[model samples]
Target: MRYVVQVFASAFRIRKIVNDGEFCILYSDSDPSIDCIYVTDKWILSNQAKPGGYYIAYDNGDSEYVEEDEFKMRATFVDQD
Candidate 1:
């Protein structure tokens, strides 16, 4: 698995993990006033995540699985793999 970590000129940053051509939002916090997006393999619910899709964890303990297309739109791929 490959990973890309992006840091912006802000109080937070975004980190992503790529596994087998799949992209997941590991962590992201662009605004300090809002809750950050934090998700990992352990946070994925049973059978909730699909192939090419990943979960996004919230501060309230909520999570949502988004598809690959959405991930691409939300994230910026810096390099080719």
Candidate 2:
């Protein structure tokens, strides 16, 4: 069996698994119109800390800024059971 990993960037972006692990590493992108953040696959969970990076996976690749909100953007690494 095969499993695909994904990264939910924001509201408009979803990146595929470029790397694998509890600490996945992916590319990061940014837009210049909205008050948003760009993230990369390179990430870690709250309890864990890896490298620092981000990507604008969603948001139509535009700079349409909006109020700050929180979403449970998460990633995990473990041998499937």
Candidate 3:
């Protein structure tokens, strides 16, 4: 299963996500040590960073738009699996 996650973050980090050859690993800006989520290259809609956030369109037609702060809080404890 794959999901499209919309992420809000710095340009530098976003660039890194886009350039990564394998997959997109979302990291928390406040705590760089924490990895928020992982999106494989197969599910990515586009490598380009959009104005609102990083939009990843899911294959099942379900997508999520999350701000950096909200995502950090959720990713801290919630098991995405």
**Candidate numbers, best lDDT first, in rank order:** 1, 3, 2
Each prediction's total of clashing residue pairs, residues at least 3 apart in sequence or on different chains, is: 0, 16, 1
Q: What is the C-alpha lDDT profile of model 3 across 11-72, one tens digit per residue?
A: 11222344267766554333344445566655445433322343333456554545446545
Best by lDDT: 1
lDDT of 2: 0.32
**Each model's lDDT:** 0.45, 0.32, 0.43
Which model is ahead, 1 or 3, in terms of lDDT?
1
lDDT of 3: 0.43
**Cα lDDT, model 2, residue 18:** 43
Instruction: Provide TM-scores for the models.
Output: 0.32, 0.18, 0.29
Question: How do all the candidates rank in terms of TM-score, highest first?
Answer: 1, 3, 2
- For candidate 1, lDDT tens digit of each residue in 1-81? 999964332222333433432333334333344343434555445435544464444455555666667666666544431
Error of 2 at 54 (Å): 3.6
